[model samples]
Target: MTRSATARTRILNCTLTLSIILHAPLALAKTPVATGTGGAVATISEQASRSALAILDKGGNAIDAAVAAAATLGVTDPFSCGIGGGGFMVIYLAKDKRVITIDHRETAPAAFTPATFLENGKEIDFDTAVASGAAVGVPGTVRGWHEALERYGTMNFKQVLAPAIDVANQGFTVTDIFSRLTRENERKFQQFGTTSALYLRDGKALPAGTMLRNPGMAKAYREIAARGQRAFYTGPMARAIVDAVNRPPVAGGAGVRAGKMTLADLANYEARIRQPVASTYRGYALYGMPLPSSGGVTVAEALNILEGYDLKAMPRADAEHLYLEASRLAFADRNAYLADPEYVDAPVAGLLSKAFAAQRRTAIDPKRAAASVAAGDPYAYQEDQSIPLRPQARPLQKENAHTTHFTVSDKDGNVVSYTFTIESWGGSGIVVPGYGFLLNNEMTDFDFSGPRPNVPEAGKRPRSSMAPTIALKDGKPAFTIGSPGGSTIITTVLQTIVNHVDFGMPMDAAINAPRLSERNGAATSVEPGFAGSAQARALEAFGHTWEATPEEIGAANALVFNPDGTVTAVSEGRRHGVGSALVQRKGH
Candidate 1:
């Protein structure tokens, strides 16, 4: 057969297999809320959810299911996450009753410096910086997956990777979001020969409903499945990745300078197991990702401030004002203190301290928003006074909207809340030749030209807004929650927890509730559902400016553990993603 004929046949066969797998009677039985005596999985992709459920059905634990689901997402939702990205995972181990956090965030190359993005004493153009090799960070997703599997998962890498490999090889139907994103990023993708070959066909973006096959991605997965983490970080794939990042920009393009990442950077990458930042609110313990990710500290600080108010007794308007007020304060601290702990002292202990939060809370006026909030002296509350406290510099905040989040839990009570990203949609818009994946532009998360703690530094992980969290009640996992919305991630997670604990809503309702986000900025953005409501009017009355943005507040997914041992899983349903709970088959 001709090469084109073979390609067509493969695509056809893959489509048939996908149809059978997705529409089979057993698969059809899976619902958004699957009540199984065994386990449940909630994620942003249907294929990913199914893959996770299959792992559960095969007697794999929650970690196994999460790894399986995350890998499948790399294949099905490549625009948001892939092996080339990095993330954080919060895992609850049932047997040991322990919660562990894995920090696989991408790091700046060894050659990076504070002035990497500055040219002639001015910051380079943001668009040019985003599309250039300088934006590429040493990817940590593959190492993170390996660490999770080795430490917590029961299945081997090969077993968990098979589903993703099959998905990439067989092909999947593209959704409207995918098609739209491709069109929006067509220029960036076309700037590179390799990216254009993968994302575009005949100089045109693929339309929705088309079968998108990525045999090259399948091969990459296969290699990893066979050789383990070394395949990606120390072998042929590593060389290919470095080569692509260092490749010259397309002729006449306004791309930034070539990357200086070395193969040593890839080989030295390790996913650290960090202590989760913990706090208590309304008798529940909230655990979130630590430094490098400002999520936990910020959430904890906000909740601590809110704990002073009787939210249920207060008028809804007053509660809304207080919520936004606390968010502003927490974000103020986040901007000042949060960064890669390896490069800066993040003052985690001071930031999450209830006493400090109480002190900060005193500045909030229930009747009106503050004119402007500034970072507090949380370090003053700490016993260790040796940590230098520097004057905080306000850095320009960049919006990164593309990322993926998933939650999984097994009947035995193991749970996983994972959020991963490539920094933005299509990432740096550069593809490793024949690798079939986009590399992360996570380096752009750093402050480009500022004296901020998060400014780029060699071997430093970029400050991330990806917050994966788990709430515990009475020392057991109560809920697993997270979202994707750049700076909005902190507020989204805060609101969801509030909706559940304070508003008395179920997991699904809490996730679906209207969201309002303010990141200590000039304007607060509200969803359409809340734009004209009494709450918005009240917030406006409080001297807060409202920006009615069409942007989705968050794409959050969560799993609530019922007292009766049943699990309720929910996907935000903001974007076109599906959620499911898995039940054990009679024969299985």
Candidate 2:
């Protein structure tokens, strides 16, 4: 961020803080807004945020705090994420002055084929596949946690896993979101005896404020803490996971399609260390997770396209229109060429090139939106021009607002931005019997009908839009941010950066603001705030089409590093029943 941008943010923060403090301290306490010196964390729940703060207070580093916080989310926010799922992590090691990424995205089992989700020659029912064992992949979160602590954390599983264990064993109050999600997945969850028993109270959603405890999850944590990640992949834990996937434990012994996962798929799973996706916007260095995740490239391409315009000087309506159009153009290419890199030879370098973005930008008109956006060819910008483009772009189906993201920062300048998920709320609707966590339906993320890029294959990871990202200013950590909104995740992160850098909103305000997501569709998905604003009316002259939805777009978590050596952490104040933010110290 520029110095002017930083100044504008601090001013807004101070003004907003005073207003909240003077008007509503009780309500303010419930909102996730914190600033301090030693460390900071922002997550989806107060319980998870405090768990991270407790670890930071014990002198644990940012990575350690992140793992501890994530584990707590598994207990309190079980519908979203846990050890049963997998995701991506972006970390900045202060000592190295470098950014790195851990791609722990779940991998398809070795028995998977291009037609794994197909019945006979036709694609299976999407809803049916989502709730069946066939949707489960070899979970990567357990191995991911182990790999993170082993490489960058100062503490071990025994120490970092303790807080989560406590939370699961002691129980936590069911918030509005937890109950709502339980109701949303009520039918699917009832199909599995173990899942229904844990989440449903007499086949009904638990009321808010009810104390829900998961002794099974706590026991699972204890086993992992005592024996480490290997035991989770090898022994009784492994057997339980496989049995759930293959036999499905349907209540009343009803039949369900079984998965092809075997003991070997679990044992062979490994977290990978890969190069971070590097890009630049407004002279600021941006680092994000690389492919098998389309988030980094798509968001980067959108930003790069926006950089073509002087948005800071444009009218609010014009800027918003440009933002929507840029997203549309970028997503066109994202849908076309991006997927699991191991399967598709994508032009990574070309997709991130400023030249490609500039070329795409030319297609946009300042006063009008294109009727339809088509994918652009980036091969011309590729260093290796010999590469050829693949078949026609195939659209992957994406849904689920149930994934979660969190950000952490330490006084040492180390930062971790992590986004994890189980695909949908109460994922696969099958919690391992006697184990408290839900299994992922991430396999359904793959395109159902496909012989194209992203088609399922043995050991191939599905493409994801989880973009855990960190930014640098003059070669040091500036901010760590991410969100959980399925495909909208890319738009949320991109717009947050644009708001902070170009629009000069403070970190909290940027996240709190309404959002618009245009993914090459005819209508842009717009939050109510923007839809009702005068700017939305003004955009009609530009041929912009808006599809307003009552649902909030994304629940983002972010931490901004101050030049004066302090950090500002923020989580959503209204979305997802409000989020949680905390810090080790209060002032500079």
Candidate 3:
């Protein structure tokens, strides 16, 4: 290895040695909560959970188990994620004693720009764009998997992919959620030849509990297992992906508006290693993803703003009001300034600074919610304030509620918090023929109508709300948590942490608790339980406008490292469907 790589490895070796001496926590299974001594995995699927546990049982590290679980998810949770998409991965290296992030978020093609989503000098209809290949971004999951394995895993591609291939070939039982989503996008799915044949029969969703198989995904995995990432980026599969985008199916008796992807764009695709965004709150150090994902910065800033208050000592209703306000202020700043760091300037350190949070906290009126809120200036908190703060503007967009999050921990104390998506369910409504994968419509995440920072540009990643996070107590990970809920992801993660850390709720209880999301908008959205609660009534006394929604906010998967050395893994009990959490070896 090179000098820098060797140095990093030396630190890694030190941590590995220390981890070897530490006893691992085991866990329970097929349910939302698992506790034991050894290791654990929690996600949206039983197949995914089992795949990781099996890896841990066979002596794989957190990275290996995570990739195995992710591949299995691609097969089973195909609509939510697959090899056609990209995501952010946050990992705590038990050996290195530090956190690292991989920014594999999909990028805009080299020829893309602000006008790509516009038609005749006007922005195109969102639904029309979503269903066309114009929304597709370069597939990044395969390359992302390669990067994760090469950097930290002990197993080969073949070893980790074996389970996923089996699932795809043998099939898994369909559930209500899967059937419902298919029916929701039935018309759009019918438009594409490959997508239609793969997801529907006789213009209807496959019946729930039916064994659904996708030999195409199995073949795709086998090719990657044999040839590596090149199989997707530069080999035969690459041509297939390029064709699916540049020559999308006709819509409304005409060619689609914007599809400019080229083979070179796919060939040049690469995942990056980004420094983790770090901050502190309540005597604990928090580490999250850097730019490209606003979740880390926004969540940390919200917590920092809330730090000025003694939440634990206050009445629960009063404390919740403060949480909503902090979130409002943080989102104003996020919407105003955050975007792809590669294409625009962002006040990274300034956004996370305690001084900035302190200044922003002054806007909170403890007794009432603000009638209106504006973005705060964080540039002053940084030594270099050259990047001027941009004006605030709200992007017109559709809310996507189908992203997925998973958490895994190994016997060596290594932890993984991964969140990925295909943008919307059944992404782009087109599947590459013979590939058995859906392409990502992630580019539509760009602000289609603004001179804003998040406006689409060549090779720039869209700003994301996906936050995969790890909290450290005294320099060791106390717990790792993340959720999937589109824009609500930030608030979901923030409130869950506040619930557990400040209000003293158990991890499982914390996840199941009602969630509220305030984005400096006219109304704050609340779950059914929260909308009618005493707390919601109390918040209304503070002039908070409530928009009660029947839909669940987020499906979160989390793992808590206990003082007794046993680990507790938790998943959402009711959102979407019943999730699965498993431990390698549960205490007797």
Clashing pairs in 1: none
Task: List the candidate 1 regions with Cα displacement exceeding 4 Å.
Answer: 1-26, 29-31, 248-256, 393-396, 576-588
**By TM-score, how accurate is candidate 2?**
0.94
The residue-level lDDT of candidate 3 at 399 comes to 49
lDDT, model 3, position 358: 92
For candidate 3, write residues 1-588 as lDDT tens digits: 011211111110000000111134344446888777777677888888777766766778888888888988888888888888888889899898988998888888988888888778787766677777788888778888899999988888888999999999999999998898789778778878788788898878988998999999899999999998988999789888888888875434544544789889999998998889998889999988788999899999999999999999999889999999999888888888889888878887888899999999989999989855878888889999777555764522234556888777777888888888887787787788888998888887787767889888998888888888889999887987788777788888899999999999999999888888887777887777676677778889988887644456778888888898888888878876877877766744
Q: Mark the regions of model 3 whose C-alpha exceeds 4 Å error after superposition.
A: 1-29, 249-258, 393-399
lDDT of each: 0.76, 0.80, 0.80
lDDT of each residue in 457-523, candidate 1, tens digit only: 9999988877788889999988878887777788888988888898888877887777888788777
| Count of clashes in candidate 1 | 0
Candidate 1 has an lDDT of 0.76
Q: Residue 300 lDDT in model 3?
A: 96
- Model 2 over residues 1-588: C-alpha lDDT tens digits? 111211111110000000000000111254578776656667777777777777776778888888888888889888778888898888888899888888888999999998888778787766678788999989999999898999998998888889999999899998887898788778888789998899898989999999999999999999999999987899899999999999998987655789989999999998999889999888789999899999899999999999999999999889988998899888888888888988899888988999999999999988888766678889988879887665564442344554788777776777888888888776788999888888898887777666667788999998888888888888887777788877888888999999999999998999888887777775776776676577678888788877644356778888888888777788888877767676656654
Residue pair clashes in candidate 3 = 15-95, 24-38, 25-37, 25-38, 26-36, 26-37, 26-38, 27-36
Comparing 1 and 2 on lDDT, the stronger one: 2
